[model samples]
Each structure stands twice: as structure tokens, then as C-alpha cells.
Target: MQFDKPATTNPIDQLKVVGKPIHRLDGELKTTGRAMYAYEWHDKDVSYVYGYPIGAAIAKGKVKSIDASAAKKAPGVLTVVTTLDVGDLKKGKFNTAKLFGGSEIQHYHQAVAVVVAKTFEQARSAAALIKVDYEEQPGIFDLQAAMASAEKPDDSQEPDTAVGDFEAAFEAAPVTLSETYSTPDQSHSMMEPNASIAAWDGDALTVWTSSQMIDWWRTDLATTLGIDKEKIHLMSPFIGGGFGGKLFLRSDAVLAAFAAKAVGRPVKVALPRPFIANNTTHRPATIQRIRIGAERDGKITAIAHESWSGDLPGGGPETAVNQTRLLYAGANRMTAMRLATLDLPEGNAMRAPGEAPGLMALEIAIDEMAVKVGMDPIQFRIVNDTQVDPEKPERPFSHRDLIGCLERGSKAFGWDRRGAPGTRREGQWLVGMGVGAALRNNLVMPSGARVKLDKEGVVTVETDMTDIGTGSYTIIAQTAAEMLGVGIDKVAVQLGDSRFPVSAGSGGQFGANSATSGVYAACVKLREAVACKLGFDSEDVVFENGQVRSGNRSVPLAQAAADEGLVGEDTIKWGDLTKTHQQSTFGAHFVEVGVDVSTGETRIRRMLAVCAAGRILNPITARSQVIGAMTMGAGGALSEELAIDTRRGFFVNHDLAGYEVPVHADIPHQEVIFMDETDPMSSPMKAKGIGELGLCGVSAAIANAIYNATGIRVRHYPITLDKLIGELPDVA
Candidate 1:
């Protein structure tokens, strides 16, 4: 079913099941350890061996040769396959760096060989026997150092956009602010590592792996293996966490497939945690410069944002200026993104991606500009809210309540009590509160699902959509239940198998909206089928309480399909709705922080987020997602950083032992509020993506809060105490 027009009063508006705060459907399985991750996949009849990978030591250059003779003769070793065996294979569409089977070393920890053995310890022991010789070459590793060589990336549709003359407007403005901010490389650091189990039977390959997009991995794995796409079967029913790390097929899947094909047995491969950062994708570091020109009354006149980032060849830019072009109202505006070729690990999506880092700099700049204009930061953001696209004035936002988010958050957070920077003190701690506007583009993709109603009256929905810890199963069950007029207990959901209908598949926070819309479309067809079998006009039929009613006649829904199980399969295709309407989610982040005068350490006291992202499907899950993102934002502001070794051209701190991620214990209390609003143009569900929106401006709010507490502005991220120690006030 095509969503060509604005949605009207649909069956979902009933609010009986879809909007309720229902408990997560998969909680029991996860809590009981019954939900199997990729590495834990098991079968009764099949024996699976372990595969351990050997990585190249050099970041750039060619692998001269690999000597695996010792590994092949090692005890319990089944087989050893090197890059030389496969030769440079065709790269996949989603992959930036070659996963394996290539002599050219694009980055450190690029898989060089895989050792298969009867046990994991045996495989690890044998993998150490293989030695690789490489010819090292100097590589570009710094974003700031390579700024002059940065070029406009081809993948960015609009690498540069300009409106009215920004220079002229900026020169004439009474109050202005210009600053440069930096965000270091970040790691996904999700709970589940990239892992896969591969098996082959008569030239047909099957893989059970951790991936965000099942069909995407299937297609890409086929490409990398140089085999027919039809011969591959992929399954990923449960994932502990993704955060965009498993969005693409990593070396685990490729090595497992190759090992299985070579040894004639199933092979399981999981990347060692220390090798993940350089072998897989990471959030590239970015250098962003923002300039804002505003009137004395806080009306923004001109706003310009430019960012530079580095990645391997053929990779895309971070696009850190994306939100700046649309977040606020400005007559003269400009945005540009430059990409530099650095031989680091491939840079790709992580959580909110472009908007997350972009807001880290843009929102802080907004706060600085507000201070210059002598206005409250929340009021300054409110004064610049735009109902229409700032760059394209003719196009209006479908549903924007940025002002509402700010105003509501201001009152709820006690914004009136906020004092000047470094003025509020409690003993040795200085307190302050800060606010930032949040925005994320709402996206939709073609998604399909199959719904089946059996004689038992149980509805089963099958789609390739994945949960990835964002409550896909709960919300999807809610959608199917609402549409079929059944209780949540009566619906079963099967996901993350290539055999199922393809879905949007859980990334960029679009899965909840687009994938559920696909289920809604299939349910629409099922409803029609039930009406036709009951000999009632489809439009006049009413589905409720497991009964089909028309006029004075009522029949049990199970009776309509008693002869055989009924089925409905459909895809939700969109039209030009997004073109006509600027679809985006908006929110406001408010954070209170206390800084210690003696130690220059900052600690968050409490935080709140007011979000105006369309109709929330499940308040329980949406709140969970928002708070999770908020916690991640705290890490970004305070401690998360992938320490890169410039001379080595690799992330030095690749393992969790060296890396830092904030937990519930580290973060203070967090509250989330969703505005009661919906956008018809979004989808049949009328719900927009809210998870990423919760993260967009959170770091900046924290940054501004730290500044307010200490009266010291930090332009760089992960505001470590080292950067503030000397500037901190002395405790008398």
C-alpha cells in the first residue's frame, strides 16, 4: 500500500493498544538469557568450530605475504585461509574499507587471515602461529592537519549551500559570534560484538549474524563472496545492541563464511573487542567552525557552519553541518562539509551520526551567540524558531513545535531560577543550568511485511525489521494488535530472517515508524480479506472484540478463516510527501551541572528533555530510548573519545579497558516528555523518529552547563578536567 496522501482518521487512532505504556514484549526472553545472540547460535545436529582472525599490524601499505604453514600444522587446527587465498575481492556497496581478502592494508587490524579449529582456545593458539609481512607506507591520520587537503565529498548531495549573501549580513549585524569546536572520534561500544556463524550445504551458504539490516547484509555478502544472491540465507533474530556498529557486514561474517566453505563445517567468528575499532567502522573526528550574526534582540540574521573530517578513500564526509541549515531561521545562511582522505578505520553511522556531532558544536555556538546578545539561551532559541525551512522559504515544516518544546521545558526545569555564570555555589561546588534546541530529520523507507491469521485466531507478523534494543517487537506487536482488533497476547512477531519480507531494518530511528507502517498496510489487506469472506461491505465492516460486525449481523473473526489460514503481504511505498513538507523532529534539552572549584571536575546534577516528535507509539519504549540516548550524550560531553595515534594512523585506545562510556551510575536523573502531536505526512502511523532526536543537542547543553558553572568555555568535546584545571577558580 502506497502512502501517497496525508493520513486521515485511521484504525490506529483507537489508542486501545498502540499508545498505551505496554511492557516490552521481549523482556522475559532477554532477562532469562533465552534470547540468543549471533555468537551463541546453536543447533542440535550441527557441530560448529571456532574461527580466530589475524589482523595486519600496519595501517597502510601492502601485505607482502602471510606464512600460515605453522598454523596449518598446529594441533586441533582445521584450516587456515589468508588474504592471498581469496585475492582482492569485490567491495560491497555499504563497505568503505575492504573487510578481508586483499593484500592492500587500508587500515590497522584489517583481517589478514583466519584460523579455524575444534575449539576457541585452539583457534586462538593457532592464530598466533601465523605471521604476516607488510610493507608500511605513511598515512594521513589527522583531521586538523589535513584541513587544507580536504575536498568536497561526492556522496554529499549538497556539499555546500548558500542563501542570501552571508558575508554582507554578518558584517552589518550588531552582535556576532564565531568559534571553532572539535569532536573526537567515537566508538559504538555496544554490548554485542560483531559475530557470525556461517555454514554451507551443496554450494548454498547460510549465515546467522548480528546485523541491523538483514537484506542489506545478504546482498552485500553475496557481492563480497562473488556468488548468486539467491544462494545465501541470513538470520539475525536477536541482537543485544547495535548503535549502527553492525549496520554493515564486518569481517566476522566474511571470515566465517570463507572458513566454513574451506573446512566443510560450520564456523563461528567473533571479532576480538580490542580489534573492533580499527577493523570495523567508527564515528570520525570532526573540526567544525560556526559563525552566527544576530540582532541585539536575539534575532539571527546570518548563520554559517562548515566542518571537516577524515576517512579512508571513497568514504563520505561526516556532514556535521546538516542540522544547522534547517534548525533555525536565518535569512543569510551557508553550510559546507569537506572530507579528507585519512587511512583510519572506515567512518560510518553511529547513533544519530551527522546531527549528533553537528549539534555538539552548533548548539554550543547558539549558546555563545545568546550570551553575546544578552538574552536567555532558551528565549534566544525560541526567538529563532522557524515553521518553514530556512533555506527554502517556500517549503513549510509539516509539524514543528520547537518553541513549544522550549517554553514547556523552560517552565518545567525552573529556568527562571538560573543565575549568571559561576554565581550559584553550594560549598565547593558551583551550579548552573543550560538549554539547547534539538532537531533530527525524520526519514522513511519502503518497508514490507507479511501477516498471517490462523484458525486459532492468532496473528503472526513476519518482517526483516530488527529490534537493536529500541523496542521494535513491542511497538510492532502493538501496531498489528491495534489493526487486527486483537489483544497483544494473540499476536506473534518473527523478525531478522532473509526469508521474511524486507523492512526498513532498524537504523536512524526510522524502523519504528516505517516498519510498523508496513505492518499496518498488510493488516489493511487482511481486514479486507476478512470482510469479503463474511459477505459484508469492507467499508461498513467493523472489527472489534474478535468479531466482525456489519449492521445487525456479527460473526466471530475466527469463523472467517476457519477453512484455511488467511494471509496478507504488502509494502508501504511513499510519494512526494517529504518533498512538499519538511519533516523533522524537534526537542529541547535542559541540563543542570555542578563543577568543583578545587578539582575542576564537572558532574551532572539532573537533566530533562522535552520532545515534540510526532505521535509516540509506546511511551514506555520511547522513554527508554530517550533516556538511553541522553546517557550516551553525557558520555559524549564528558568522557567518550577514541584516542588516535597520529604517527600510527590508528585509534590507540581500541578496547573498552582504555575507552570510557558512562552508565546509569555515572549519569544523574533524566526525565523525558513527549508533546501530544502527530504528523500525517510522516506515515500511516503518523509517528516520527524520536530516539536520535533525544541525542542531538544534549552534549551542547551539557557543554553550556559546564561553561555556566565555571565561566570557562570549552570548544572541544569530552571536556576533560585537564583542559579546565589551570583556568578553574581557586577555592579560598
Candidate 2:
């Protein structure tokens, strides 16, 4: 099914189930601890061995040698698989670094070997016995130190964008503001670590893993194993959590597969908590410099954003300047990104990626410019909002409600009550409020699904779409139920299996809309099949109450598939609609913060986000996603940072005990508002993604609020108490 033009009236327009606030269908299983995760899978008959991985100690070096003989002969160890044994295996397409089988170490904690044993304890004990000698070399570990050698990367979204003479425009402006902001590297820190259970039967291998993209993992696993793609099977129905860490193949799955093949039995491997941060990918730290020139009335005349980030060789930049090219209206604008070489693990996607950290700097710059021009922050943002792409004026937004989000959010958050900076005091605390605009690009991918209508009037939808605790199963069931005119109970959703039809997978907030759109297309095909089987005109047939009706003639839908289950398979292929028009999600974030007068400690009082992403598939699920993102944003603004050891060339705080995220005590009440909106060019569901949009600009709002509470502006992220104590006003 091709989506070439704007969508018109469809079954989803009925809003019977797809738009309802439906509870998660798998909620009970999760709460009861019945839903099996990767490490929890149990096979009744097959004996399973445990595999423990050994990671490289040096960040960059060549292996002198690895002696695994002691490990193999110790305890109940069966065999040992080392990178030296495999000798330069092919790297997976999605992986920026090699997962296994390499003598050269690119980063610290890279998998060097896996020791298989009858018990986990034995495997762990044996793994500790394995000795390794490495010839270490000095490597770049600090982004700021390596910035002088940074180079411009080659890619479509590699920044370096300009429309007009930004320098001249800025020089002529009446008011101008320039500032530099820094955001440190961040970890996914999801509840579930990378884990996998692999078993082999003859030439075929199957893996049960915690992954976000089943198809990507399957393909990459096959590539890493040097086997045919058909020989690999991957299943990841339920995930503990994956911000963006599990989007590609990880070490656990590959190591488990190798150990299983070596031992001739099923094997399981789980990366220890310590290995998760240094072994896997993390969000790269960034140094962003923003310059804004505005008229006396707060109209932005010139805007420029330049960012620098570090990554491994052949790696991409952090792309922290992407949102500046499109977020607000500026006649003369420039944005550029530079990539520096660093060996502190492979930097990759985390949550909203470019936009999340980008907005943390850009939105705050807008606030500072607003203060310089003597205008309200919200009004300044609203006045600069662009309906058309700022760089390409001919391409107008398909549907944008940035102003609506700002106005509505301001009212709900009581913006008028917000007093001057450092003026509003309540007892021992200074209170203030701040606002930031949210922007995330809407993305569409070709997604496929298979639908089956059983003779018992049951509808089943199957796709490789993953549910990373984002309520994917519930909303997918809703889409099927709404399209088939059946109760939600009559639909079953199967997901996260490579054997199923490929989908867009669950990253970039595109899963809900793209995967469900695939299901919608398949359901349409099933409806037509039912009409044909019942000898009714497919065009005139109305499916309602589990019956196919045409002009007073009605027949039970079960009659169409009484002999056997009817199956419909189709892929939703998108056209040039996305290219023809600018499609993006818009939202506004408002935050209230209280700063301790003497301690300079900041605490969030409340948070509200007004979003206009499109027609939300399910309000309950979308709201949950928003609040969770808000919590993460709070952590990023106040605590989260992957502290790097510049001399050691690795993240110093590798464990959760050292790294800090927001806990229940740190978060206050959170509120989310969804504007009434639908984009015809989006899809048949008319819904854009809201998950990533919820995280964007939230941290900036908190930063702005803290600045309001205390007259000190924090340019560095993780605005810890140490950074504020010096600038805070002296207390009585």
C-alpha cells in the first residue's frame, strides 16, 4: 500500500479504539512478572550453559596476547572463545565498532573473550582467571582538548548550513547575545542490561535477546557470525527499557552465539552492570556556541549555532546544531558541527538524539536574547515561530501549532504569576518559572505487517515492531480492533520476531505511527478480502458489529473465513509527501524550580508540556511517554553525566552508584497537554511521533527556571550545586 498523497476519510477516523485511552494489554503480565525477558527464558529439556565475557582494559592498543588455557581448564569451564581465536571477523553494518573477534582494541571494555561454563558462578570465576597483556597507547579522551584537531564530517545532516550573510546581519542588529553551553556525555541507564540467550539446532541458530530492533539485530548477528541471514532467528517481544542503546547489535548476543556454537549447547550471557556504560554506546558530550542578534522588539535578525563533539575514528559528529536550522524564523542563519577524534567508547543515539541536546542550548540562548531585548520569553518564541522552513521558504509545514502549544502551556503553567528573576521568595527558597519550545522532526519509513483473520472472528497482527515499555502492543491492538470493527479483546498482537514481517522498529519515536500504519494497510486488505469472499461489492461494503453489510444485506465476517484463516500482507511505502512539505512535531515545555537560598540546590516544583504532534493514537500511552521523558530530562539537567577520565581514556563513573539520574524524590508533579491536531500528509492514522518530542527542550526549561530562581546563568549542563554556589545571592 503506497501513501503517495494526503490521507482522506478512513476507518481510523471513527476513533472507536485507536484514539481511546486504552490500558496496556500486556500490563498484567508485566506487573505479575510473567512476561519473560531475555535472561529469564527457560528451556525444559535442553541443558543451558552460562557464558561470562572478558572485556579489554586498554582504550586503544594492540593485544600482546591472551592466555585462556587457565580459564578453560578451571572450574566447570567447557571452552573459551576469544577475539584472538576468531581473528578479524567482519563488522556488522549498523555497528560503528567491531563487536567481537579483533586483536586491536578501539575502546575500553571492548569484548575480548567469552568463557563458557556449566554455572554462571563458575563462568565468572573462570573469566577472572583469564590473563591478558596489552600494549597501550595514549588516546584522545577529552572533547574540549581534541577540538583543535576536529574536522568537518561528510554527511547529509552534518550541519554547515547557511542561508544569508549572518555576520553582517548580526553586526547591524540593535541587540545581540553570545554564549557557550556544554552538555556532557550521557548513558542510556535502562533497567535491563544487554542480555541474550542463544541456542543452535544444526545449521540454524535462534537468539532470545533484549533488543529494540529485531530485524537490525538479526541481520547484524548473521553478519557477525558469518552465516546466511536465513540461518539466524531473533526474538525480543518485551524489553525492560531501551532509550537508544539496544537499537543495534550488542556484545551479549554475539558472545552468547559464539559460546553456544563452541559448547554445542544453549548458552546465555548478560553484561555486568559495570560493562554496560563502557562497552555499549553513549550520547556524546557537546560544546555549543550560540549567537543571536535581535531587534529591540525581540525579532531575531541573525542566528548562528556551532557545536563540537568527539567520537572514535570514522565516527559521526553529535549533530547538536541540527534543530537550529529549522526551529525558529531567522532571515540570516548559520549552523555548523565539527567532529573530534576521541576513544571514550562509541558515541551514538540516545533518546531524541540531535534535537534533545541541541534544544538544551538553543532554547536557552533564545531566553537570554529575549532578556537582552526586553521581551517575554514565551512571546519572543511565538513571534519568531515559522510556518515555513526558515532555510527553504517555499516548503511550508504540513501542520504546525507551535504558537498554540506555547499559549496553552503558558496559561496552564500560570506564566503571569512568574515574577522577576531572583525576586520571588517563599520562606527558605527562591521560586521562578521558565519556558522552552520543543521541536522534533517527523520521520516515515517503509513498514510491513501481516494480518490474519481466523474463523472464530479473531484478528491477529504480526510485525517486527518492538515495545520498549512505550505501550506498543496496546495501541497496535487498538488499530486492528478499530479497523476490523471488533472489540479490543478480539485482537492479538505479535511483535519483535525476525520471522515476522519487517517494521520500522522502535527508535526515533517513529515506531507507533509507522508500524501501526503498516498494520492499517494490512487491515484494509483483509477488509477487502472479506467483502470479496462474501460476494459483496468491496467499495460499498460496511464492516460493523462483526458483520459485512451492503445495502441491507449483511453476513457474519466469520462466514468469509469459515474454511480457514484469511491472511493479508502488505507494506506501507511512503512517497514524496515528506519531501514536498516540512513535517515536524511541535511542543512547549514549562518548568517551575525552587532554589535553596543558602545551599544553591535546585528542586523542580512542577512541569507541564503542551504538545502538538498530531492525532495521538492513545492519550494514556502518549502521556506516559511524555512524563517518563520529563523525568529523564530532569536528570540530564540536574545530575546525569558520564564523567570521563582524560588520562585513562574511559568514562570514570561507569557504575550507577557514581552516575546520577532523577529518583522519585527529585521529581514533582508533571502535566501533559495534547493539542487537537492531525496532519493529512503524515499517514493514514494522521499521527506523528510524540515520544522524542517530549524530551526535547525539557532540560533547557529546567535550566532557565533555575536561572530565574537564582540570578546566576549556568552554561554548563548537569547544573550541579558546585557550579551555582559562587554566583548565588548571599542569604540572610
lDDT of 2 by residue, 1-732 (tens): 999999999989999888899999999999999999999999788788999999999999988899988898997999999999988988888898888997899999999999999999999999999999999999999888899998888766555988899999999999998899999999999999999999999989999999998888998888888999999989999999999999999999999999999989999999998788999999999999999998998888999999999888878888888889889998999999999999889999999999999999998999998889888999999889999999999999999999999999999999999888889999988898989899999988878999999999999999999999999999999998988888999899999999999999999989899999999999999998888888889888887778888998988877788868798889999999977799999999999999988888899999999999999999999999999999999999999999888888888888889989899999999999999999989999999998999999999999999888886788899999998887676631
Residue 295 local lDDT, model 2: 90
**What is the alpha-carbon lDDT of model 2 when measured against the actual structure?**
0.92
lDDT of 2 at 620: 97
Name the lDDT value of residue 391 in candidate 2.
Answer: 91
lDDT per prediction? 0.92, 0.92
Q: In model 1, state the lDDT of residue 605.
A: 98
Candidate 1 overall lDDT versus native: 0.92
Number of colliding residue pairs in each model: 0, 0
Q: On a 0 to 100 scale, what is the lDDT of residue 328 in model 1?
A: 93
Q: How many clashing pairs in candidate 2?
A: 0
